[model samples]
Target chain A: MIRRSVAVAAAKLTGGLSRRLGFGGGTALPGLVAERIDPEIVSDMAAQLGRGSVLVTGTNGKTTTARLLRGILRSSGLSPVANSAGSNMMRGIAAALAESATWTGDIRQRDRRIGVFEVDEATLPQAVSALRPRAIVFTNLFRDQLDRYGEVEYVGGIWRETIDGLDAKVTVILNADDPSLAALGRRAGLRTLFFGLEDESLAIEKLEHAADARWCSICGRELSYSAIYYGHLGHWRCEGCDTSRPGVEVGITSIETFPEALSLTVSLPNDQTAQFKLPLSGLYNAYNALAAAAAASALGATNHDIERGLRHASATFGRQERLTIEGRDVEVILAKNPAGLNEVLRTITNNGRSENIVFFLNDDIADGRDISWIWDVDFELLSGSLKNVTVSGIRAWDMALRLKYAGFDTFDRVELDTERALRKALTETPEGEPLIVVPTYTAMLDVREMLARWAGKKAFWQED
Target chain B: MAKKLRVAHLYPKLMNIYGDRGNILCLKRRCEERGLDFELDELSVGEKLKSDHYDLIFIGGAQDVDQRRVAGDLREVKGDALREAVENGVVVLAVCGGYQLMGRYYRTAEGAELPGVGLLDMWTIHPGEADKRFIGNIVVEWNGGTLVGFENHGGRTYLGDGARPLGKVVYGFGNNGEDAGEGAARAGVFGTYLHGSLLPKNPKFADHVIQAALSRRYEGIELDEIDDRVEEAAHAAAVQLAMGRSII
Candidate 1:
């Protein structure tokens, strides 16, 4: 325990040094420290706390769920040791653990009640093996990192294999709407909790083929969907296996969409339900909240605490996080894939206001140099109410052209000069309306930096 | 009325990444500049590939699973339609997984092997899954012309004995084979793993394919000139970066 604490502290020092040197790299320094010392230093530090651990992993919604779970745990009056900086890797987790550990290489027992860590999907199997988290929350899996992970089914198979190897005591919370994830719950001896949206009103009439899970995992039959919430995730069933979305233990009933304030009704594990209002938008966020709630219930959090956390929690960076600058409101939403962007488009259109939107696309190394994914995004979801959209970033024109091809009017289309685009988009926004800025990975970082500078808040992610 | 070059984009609805449609646009713009007519026939499944009507046939790459799904349908294609077209001097270009599918067979380590359309004798073999993700500009020397683009594929391809090499490998595993850089027949079909919509980075290669298609119709015909602004500083930077040469 003492050695583990020392290693975490050292990792923290490494992260601090990297930040002090203005190096934005996330895993390089703490990786070195973890390598030199105990390789499982991060997990060991968390284990030393005597508190159970819950890990959340997925392509999207991981960051949002992590933030929600942290708030709920804090509201429950438990000193929760979490990766507050949004760092999910071994070194990042070590740095996070180092922040809470005492100098004597021991977690302060009084300060440690539970730990929640959001892990990268690619690294989940390794981290879960070492951490042996008490519960794991999976939001949904999509076709992300095609160059690295191949396809979504390939990732689904890996997740199943990883979960199968876990100890029988571990609980798994899954999104029942996802065919790939919900199928995992069918296996025996696995303690699984299913959470999803039962609200049929949020479903789209037609399924978008950009990257959807249209086939059933069990029977190899094509899934028949009554409606689609996002790509492939909705009320679906397989005729061959007779498998479908089971009765949701926890469900997102209603989402009251408000500017900077959204509310939802969640069915708690205790049979009683709680209505919580959040300052976030879109149905995807409702799923994020349900995942956090399900994991919190697994962690023994009370309904009251979950309610408070949902209402009191501020938005994390880029997940419908609202930033105010010069009396204009900018809703910074991260749209990495087609499903995410489609949801953003739906949420903005649901507002029924003609507002200027800033769409940022960066074909950076992390953003998948193949920007062809833009063709799959349902930009057609934006109807006549949507005002001019200012495209910006590396592939801004590419995005604009995609929108144009989708039958969107190009009259309001503007080239994406990042600085000028942001300024012009924000300034052109009519008063009393929110401006939506959709950005991919690197573009999200750039917009987050811009917001952080204006809002006078330091970026809390673990990168450096 | 001058006849427009009839082009059929085969298998576009699938196996297109890196915005492969950008290639179609590049071709369209080039043709428009030279006052040459261009009509695109998007022939997906259930659509026939009429060899006599079209001048150029272009196919893009698909994922391994999609490749398997499309393989059976592609085998049903009238080989004579394509082979005859090629025999009579029709232009054909396939990129990435499309290039692999045009060959004999693509075998994966998972024990799954799908038969290729036999447009090319070469075959692709997946030797234990590996992520050969090579980003940024890629340069390849081919037939006195330099082809540059980006490549990200898992399977390595081996060239058949009768095939001619595309170019010398500047970087990455060229075609995944020991000797050949890519699969290219100087006078006929052109196949490579390069993508950034291949032609945008090097218009000369696209032009070669177009000229070959037009030569059969209009002997000694002079196509209109295209002024590619990208051939300026931006492209020079990309070329420098693709080569081992530093821009700084």
Candidate 2:
């Protein structure tokens, strides 16, 4: 106990020093240093939380879902510790857990504290054991970080094993629209709550190019889809087998998406319905809201509490976050994978105005070294009358090539430097027109810091 | 009207991983840009492959499950037709998983031997199961010009003595990590793991295939050169990226 206390104090000191030196977030460094002293520090620390933990994970929307859940939980008068910096590894979770702890290893707000975290898909099993979550939320999974995570089916395999090994008492929250995820509800004697979008009006006319899960997992035959929302999320049924879209306990039946916010009518499991005008934009956000509400409900949050909490939901930093700069509306949407980028493009195209945009692509370790996935995105949809596009970041040329092939004339607008690229894009945009800035994971961080500095907003780590 | 080129995109529904449909799209666009009648046929699993139907054939990469399924479909179903097409001197370009399937066999990391179509005298072996994929931007010296594309593959392909490589590796691990050879090329048949839509960055290579396919049906026909500035710029940028230089 004495050694663990000393280790925690040292970790906290490292984080403080790094932040003071402007090392950027310093969220993982403290936890990494602490783990060197005591490897089991996360499980040990999580043991102290009385309300236990609720884990949110998927290929995308984990960060957004966790943020919404955190807000909803807080509104219900429960204090929860969350990692809102978009960090999900063991180290980041530890940092967030340690921040709410004292130098003497005593957790702050012991009676009401809960751990609400977004975990990486590959690290879900390890995190589930360490956090010991009472409720696990499975958001929709798509083909993401292919070079890093291989195939989505591989991750699903891991998830099945992890789910099988979990405690029977732990509740499972799943997306019924996703066939692989919805199938998890059939696991023997496990408690599962399913959530999905039920409105066929929001269905896309045709499936995107990079969509996956076309074949039935059970029979390996073609799965017929009545409507595909995005990347295999929709009303689907396998003709060969009886498997199909399950009945959702919590569902979003209708959604009105706008440039500023989304209005949704959600059906909860208790046979009650709630209407919320969530301040977040896009159909994807509506799904996140439903997932958050379901997860919060599993933790005993009332329908009133969930609706009240969701009504106040906002973008989780760099996630469809809009800022007005000198009368120009610039929305920063994080695009890390084909599915995520397609959603952002759909949201932008929803306005039907030829969008002036900037795309930042990086090939750093965190961003997936293989940048070939850029081609997987169907960018031809943005060709209606795109005003202009500036491609930037470390792999700026690759992005520019991809856009050019996607039928966008970005040959004369490639900028390798992200800062200069933003300036150029901003300068070229007409007054009052929304300039969309689509960036990968690391690029989003850089763009966020740049925007935050100009607006005097707190850094991500500082805010969380 | 120009000469028609029948193009068969094999297993588009199942084997088009890593955005390889972009390659087919590029082929169609280039053919039409040059005033050629391009007919693209998508052959999925359980579909019969007509040996004489296509002038040029393209096969893309796939994931492990799809690859195994495709290998069986190739062996038990379309193997003879594909072999006949190859022997008939049809211009064919296969990438990554397609390249592996055209070989004698692919020995998986789990020690299972999946049969291949045996068009190329080669075999592939996976080095390890985790984090061993050869993935990155690659530059190759092929067809007397530079070709730049992205490669991500778990198996290392070894060419037998009778086969010839498509190019020498200017960068990245190609074929086997030690051979420094990229792919296998014989006559009008070509195979490589490079699929940044392989041909968009190398219009010359794309044209070479178009010309080869056209020549198979017609005599003394040369494709007119359209302005390749945009394609060349993108190509140069990729080449620069491969050579460890920024294309700002």
Candidate 3:
């Protein structure tokens, strides 16, 4: 107990010093310090939550889904603790718990506290062994950070191992539209609930070029899809083994995508229907909303609570975030993988067209050193839509080459410096026109910091 | 009149884990820019290769499961036709897993030997999971110039007397860390682990491939050069990055 108290105080002091020194958002540092002091810090703090915890993980939609679930839990009169700034590793979870705890290592509102965390794919196993949460929610999986995760199959293999080791009482929340994820849930023999989109009007005839999960997990044959919403997700079945997508307990019956919001009607598991307007847009967020709703239902939240939670949900930082910079309307969308980028392009092109856009690509460890995935992204979707396009970041020339091959005759400018590129893109945009900014993971952080400073807002860590 | 080239992409749906389709896009754009009528055919599982139909063939990387499945299909259905094409000087390019499957065999870390197409006199062995994979930005010296791309592979390959190395590694591990060798080449067939699509940045190498394909129909044909300023810049930047220097 004394060691835990000392660890908490040291972590809080380190985080305060980190923020005062302008080091970063102090998201992962405090957790690092706390772990060095107390190796069991995460497990120790997570145990104090009376309602246990729920883990959300996948390649994409983790942050958004966790944020929405936190809101829903809170709307249900429960206090939820989350890593809200998108720092999603074990250390980030530690920092979030540390920040919420008192110096004496006691959680505030101990009886009502529920740990809500969005963990990285590779870190999920360690997190599960530590937190031992009551429920695990998996969003769709795509080929992301190949250098780090090896491949999608490798991730799935680890997840299967993790699920097999879990207690039978733990509920597994899955996305039914993803064949591999659904298969994982089916084979786990644990309590499982599925959520998916049932709207055919939003389906595409063919799978996108970057779809990753097409093979059947049970039979190893190519799975055929009747309708592909995006990537390899949709109503799919294996011709070889005759295994198909599981029945969805919580499904979206209809969806309406607007420029700034998504209006969706969800059919809950209790035979109750809820209509809510999510302030976030795109079909990806719609999936996140569905996953959150299903997980909330498993956590004993009511339909009214789910509806109100989703209705009041807002965008996480750097994810469909809208800002007015220098009197120019700018929207920052974080895209790191081929499937994610394709969805972003589809959403932007489908709703409203932007004349000026800036693309940032970085090869930092967080962004995956292999930038070849850019070729897999169907940038041809925006072939002739833009009047001015600026490319920047560490691999600006590579992006420029990609655009050239995509039939863009020329670029407005290719700037390696992100700040300069963002400034130039904003200046080139005509008044009253929106400027779209697409950046990788690390590039998004840099751009977000600059934008926050310009907007006279506090740093992300200081926001809440 | 425009000259025509037929390219066959092998196992496009199954073996395309990396950005392998980018190589096809690069080839098509380069051919179209130079007034060559480009035709592409995708050959997946259970698909056979037609004799005298294609001038060039491409196969990309895949995971272990997909690679094992493709190995069976390749040896059973398309082995003889592919060997005949190679003997006839048809240009072939295979990256990563494709490169492993074209060799004699691949010994997995678990002691199982998966047979290859035997197109090259090379074999690969995965030294178990305890060993580190050769993965990073790579720079190589090939054809009197520098070739820069990214390589990620767990199997370490060694070439035999039947094949010559494609290049000497200048930086990063290639083929195997014990050897300075990168890839293998013989009779118009080239195999490597480099998968920065391996063509977009290396325009000179791309031209070499194009020239080799065009030579099949038109002997001593000289190809016109499109502006490659962006391609060259990207290549140099990658090389600089591999050399541990800042690229700006």
Candidate 4:
């Protein structure tokens, strides 16, 4: 107990020092320091949450779903401790827990606290063992950071192993529309609940090039989809073995995507329905909301609480996060992988109001050194719609080349420096029009920092 | 009327990992930009390859499991056709896993040998799970020009005496990393681990592929150079990045 107390104090001190030194978020460092001092820091702190933890994980929408779940938990009168800034590794969870704990390693109001963590796909196994969450929500998986995660199936393999090791009491909330997740839920013996989109209006005619998990897990044969709602996600069934998507407990009956928000009518498990307007757009967010609702409901949040929570839920950082810069609305959307980029493009163009857009493509380690995924994105979707396009970051020329190949003859500007590109993009935007900024993971962080500073707001890590 | 180039994309659905479809898109866009008709045919598992039908054949990389499935189909169904096409000097481009499958055989880390199509006289051996995979931005010297792309592979390939190296490694790991040889090339078939979609940034190499494919039907046709300033800039930037960052 003394050692644990010392570890907590050291971690808090390290976090404060790092924040003061502007070391960028101090999200993972304090946890690293704490773990070195006491290896049992995560399990120790997570045990204090009487309501237990709920882990949200997947390749995409983990942050947003976890944020929404946190909102739902809060609405249900439960105080949730979360790694809210999207630092989702084991150390990030440790940092969030360490920050919540007192110097003596005791969590104040322990019975009321619930750990709401968005864990990384690669770190899910470690997180599950350490946090021992009461519920786990999986958003749809897509090919993301291939250099780090290898392949999508590799992630699925790890997830299967993790789920197989989980206790039977732990609830598993899955996206039934995602064939891979649906298959996982079917195989996993734990208490599982599924959420899916039943609206055929949001379905695409064919699977996009970026779709992964096309093969049925049970039979190893190609699964046929009745409707593909973006990437390999929809009503699917295997012809080889007759395996198919499980019946969804929480399903989106209808989704109406607006210019700035999405109106959804979600059908709950017991024929009860919850209709709410989420202050976010796109079918991806709709999936996130469904995942959140199912997980929250499983964790004992009422239908009214779910509706109220979703209605008041705002955008997570760097994900459709809107900012006002000089009276122009600048929305920053993070587009790291092909599927995510495709969805972002679809959402932005669906409104048909976006004229000025900026793309920042970085090849940093965090952004996956291979920028080849950009080619998989259907940049041709923005062929004639954009009035001005600015390409920036380390691989700005690569993006420019991609846009050129996509049939864009000329770009408004190609700037390597992000700040300069952001300035140029904002300046070129006509008054009263919105400027959409799509950046990779690291690029999004840099852009968000610059935007936050410009908007006279705190840095992402410092905010809440 | 523009001349037509028929392209056969093998296992486009299964073997299309790591943005490899970008290579096909690059080829198609370049052909269209040159006022040539680009015709594409996608062939997947259980599908037989049509001999002498395609001017160019493209096979991208895939996951390990999918690669295993493709290897079986490639050997039983399309092996003879592919080998005959290679012998007939059909322009072929294979990246990463596709390149491995075109070799004589690939020995797994667990020592199980999987037979390949043997279109290229080479073999690959995955040096166990403990050893690091060759992954990152790679720069190579090919055809008296610089070729830049990203390579991520666990298997180390060794070229037999019958095969020739595609390029010399300038930066990053290539082939077995010890040999500094990157990829294998013989006749019109080019097999490499470079998957920055290989052709989009390296427009000259893409043109070489187009030229080789067109020569079979058009005979000594010279491809008109389109504006490649953006491509060249991207290539230069990648080369610079590869040099700046030491990726083993």
Candidate 5:
């Protein structure tokens, strides 16, 4: 008991000190310190959660999905303890758990509490063993950091192995459109619930050039797709085998995407159809909503709860944050990989019009040192109308060069500093034009801070 | 009259992990800007290559599994044609995985042996400490021009005595983290880990390849100049960033 108390106290001290020193939320460090003091601190706290845990993981959309699920849990009368800041690795999850637990290592909420964590794809196996989650949501996988996570096949293989070992009681919620996750769900041989886009017109004509998962996961044959919503995700079948998109229990049928809002006509389980208007933008966020709704429903969340949560869920930081600087519209969008970036570009260029773009690319540990992925993004989509683009962050010039080769004519100052670049981009933005700020993970944080300071808003970490 | 440039894109699907398609786009766009009609023939797995059909050929890099999958197919179908193209002075630019496969062989991080085209007398091995992956912005000086790109590789390539290096590394880790070299060049073949997809950031280098191929294909055909103000600025900014003169 004394050892556990001491560990909690140490975590609190370091976390408090970290915040007081203005070094940011020190959320991960405290947990790192506590884990060093008590090896099983996370597992200990996790064991006491009567409702168990829900683990959400993938190459993208983990944070937003977790946030959306948290709202559903709240509406379902369960207090969800979640890692909202996206420090998804073990240390980050531990920090969140330790902060929410009592000094004696007991969760304050006890039976009313449910743990929700967005584990990193590479670290999913470790987290699964530690949390022993009651339900796991398998979001679609895309090619992410090659240096850090190898490739899509490697990460998918690990997820498969981990899911194979999970007990039958552990419910698996997955995206039916994703071939990789669909194959895993099939292999699980359990009553897995699936969520996917049911709107046929929403399908893209052709897959992006950098699309991964072209080969069927079950057989070595190439996959034939009726529609590629984005990347290798959407309505695909293996010609060499009977592998294909599974039957979806929770599906999105009619999607009306707007600049600030999205309305999805969802077909729920038990012959229930509900209309939901989400405050989030982009088809990617719609997919996240479907995943969250399906997971929440699998965990016994009612349709009313799912609808309310979907309606109330707002954009998580850096996903599609909107700020007005002096009456000029500025949107902060995060793009970590080629697929995500292409989606962002497509979303921003929905009307086939170019918005003033500020690109923040960094090689910090979080941003993945290889800026080569920029070449994979379809910048040509915006080349015809893109007139003003300001490149910033560590690899600002790299992005500028990519835009240039994509045949974009205008190249603003390539500012190494994100703050200065943000100002230039906003100032240069034409009157009544929205400036889309696209940043990688670390650069997004920096740009968010600068924008928050400029607009007199609280930084994301400081938000309650 | 401007002559048409026929380019072969080797392994568009299997070996395009690092945005090698961008390299193809760069070549095509440059050719278009210079008033030359650019035709691209995309060859995938099991596709055969004919030497005389293309004036320029581009092969990209891939992940370990993809590299292994494509290497054998490359040897079976396109190996002899690739050798013939290089010998005929056709401009061939290979990056990262493409560069490694142009060598005699590549030993993967898992210690698997994958044979290369052996067009250049070089070999690559994943370092003893795999954690020492040479990644980040890199600057290399070659033929009086400074080239900048991002390199993420655990394989440390060493050139044999017969092979000449593309350039001396000005900043960041080069061919092997120890050697000051960055890429290998032999005859008309150029292999580098420079994948800001190489051509877009370095228009001059892109032009160098175009001119080399054009010079060999058509005599006394002058390439027209296109406006490159934006391209030049992008290149300068990349150089400044890579040289550490501009702190990000």
Candidate 6:
């Protein structure tokens, strides 16, 4: 009783001060609230809503899909409290809730009809238990952290178990391009809708190192791939079972890669193809957009609204988020895993320039603490023709070794001195070619801070 | 265009994780500098691996499943041909899982034991008795010289009495064993879990492996004088780590 009163007082104080300060929920507020009240207080707080919420979860494209859905919901006459700050954890969701709430812990009734949430896979079971979402959108499952997440199959098993007990009213959205995720729709019946790519141009002729989709999940037959987009996400089928990348209701009709942006033509369920241009590179974003459209369609959003909202949506922080660093247009790509890195490498090389490339590999605790994934990335793709490769970060030498083995020739071996490498890599950039810096999570933070120090206020400008 | 080296890359597509191809590129470029041949043959499963014609026999690391799939294929090649090639002399260097498989047997975490090539007189046990997280820099002294690389693996391997130890453990868990089982060198087969890419930065080790192969093939094979720049760079990198300074 005393703890409840204290938490209420704290919430009120924080809510009152948020108007003066820019932020509302501090890092420790969620723990404070959980200790004071029942852990289910937030769910109880959300129960007052007339329409249940939509939950989106995935390993790679969660933020992109969530942002797209958020915009679509807003355009369709609904306001959503999404964790737009890129915080996808429990505390982040709590912060989003606190932002949406009043001093008395009530969601503002007049704000909107629905709330779309992008959730981390590890936190999904807890979040689903707390906030019984009316619908759940699972993008795809890939090998993320073997140290944290045993494997993709383990995560897939957990998701199957989670969805089995849900009520008949629950709607499920899955990516058919993913073998593990597409398998979820098989047993789901009418509640599930699988969305994926149909374009042949995204297909990989041969399997790369991180090929996890070798066999069919259902029949255990050898899987055949007509086209591989990235990792195992592609057009695949089991010869024994009729399993394949299910025909998506919404799909990317065409994708034209520009020197700077990706032009996509998406065919919607309403018999109209909406041409959407994202200021980012890669088909992964196209998948993200398709997922958002599918999630929005479940919530009664129209095709026109989805298109407008997608145009309004932009790339999330550090996931191909671009910035101007000391007059050079730099793209901060988070290559945490092999799939993500392969996409980054493919996108950058599409421009066909042998230019200055800076790759930072920091195997910090938060960054999976396993640098073994670097071997899986096709460094061979970057080795032969690329000009002026600069390696930096804690595992800089390690990366250098990998690059050398991949058949790349470097002028010098730059150590983990990020500041020096950044300066040299940027300053010595060939007259016309661009300098692309691919960094891991922590390295991204460090590079951003370094850029902020270098360029002052301009470094911390609007990301979109 | 200049004739690219006729370098036969044994396992280009598979048997790699951690930039193992970097080692190939390093060797190819060094060969290219002197106008040597370069040709990469991607020997995948179901493909015959005739190591007779190749100047270099390069094999890389693979996951447990991949190792199992490739094991039978590797076993098909008469060990006598490889042994004769090494005896007659062919440069062979293996890394990580590849290094483990070259020995007698490899046991995975799931308690499944797989047969190794018996190339090296050793065996590897997966999910090493201790944590395999070998981050940062490490040093190993081999043949009165120091080689630098990073060590990261979960398998603890015990050396058989007949096998020769590659180097002493200067840092990290050398081979996840008590005495820091850094590497094993027997005949022409060189095995090490260390991936300093084992070449560009450490040229001496690269030359040594190549020399060991060349000396067997030719009665008086003369190694071209190697520039000391590669060893100088590796030494400088190691010294910085030893002094606790960033060399970047």
Residue A291, candidate 3: Cα error in Å is 0.8
- Which ten-residue region of model 3 chain B has the weakest summed lDDT? B239-248
User: Candidate 5, residues B84-118: lDDT per residue as tens digits?
Assistant: 87777788888898899999999987788899999
Quote each prediction's TM-score: 0.83, 0.96, 0.98, 0.98, 0.93, 0.79
Give lDDT tens digits, candidate 1, residues A85-150.
566776666666666666555677654567788887877887787677999999998766555565
Sorted by lDDT, highest first, which candidate order results? 4, 3, 2, 5, 1, 6
lDDT of 3 by residue, A48-92 (tens): 999999999988899888988998898899999888888888889
Alpha carbon lDDT at A61, candidate 3: 92
Docking class of 4: medium
Q: What tens digits encode model 4's per-residue C-alpha lDDT throughout A211-246?
A: 999998878899898888888889999999998888
Q: Give the per-residue lDDT digits (tens) of candidate 1, residues B1-248.
A: 86578788876656564446666766776686688888998876545677777778887877666566567667776455776777777788888877888788988758688877777778888776654443444667776756766676667787767677778776545687466476555467888887765765566777887888778777776666655443332344345555643243
Alpha-carbon shift of residue B155 in model 4 (angstroms): 0.7
Clashing pairs for model 2 are B166-B183
lDDT of 2: 0.84
- lDDT for each residue of candidate 6 in A1-464, tens digit (9 for 90 to 100): 34433444564565446534644224335434543554555576557555678889988888778887887787777878766656676656665665565556666764465767788788888778878898999987766655455345556767888888777788898888888787777774548766778788868787766766566777756688898888888888988987777878777878887866677887777677888777766777778878988888777778888878777764332333555666776656677788778877877777664367888887666676556567667877765557778888876765775675566654275646888888888887765556788888778767876765565533331232
Tell me the tens digit of each residue's lDDT in model 5 across A213-259.
Answer: 88886666789998789988889888898778988999998999877
Off by over 4 Å in 5: A188-191, A314-320, A351-354, A384-387, A430-432, B109-112, B126-131, B220-248
Question: Candidate 6, B42: how far from true, in Å?
Answer: 3.1
TM-score of chain A of each: 0.90, 0.97, 0.97, 0.97, 0.96, 0.89
Off by over 4 Å in 4: A315-320, A410-412
C-alpha RMSD between model 6 and the true structure = 5.3
Worst 10 residues of 3 chain A by lDDT: A312-321
lDDT of 3 at A147: 84
CA lDDT, every prediction? 0.72, 0.84, 0.88, 0.88, 0.82, 0.69
Model 6's CAPRI class?
incorrect
Candidate 6 lDDT at B230 equals 33
B134 in model 5: Cα distance from truth in Å? 3.5
Native-to-model Cα distance after best TM-score fit, residue A158 in candidate 2, in Å = 1.4
- Count clashing residue pairs in model 5: 0
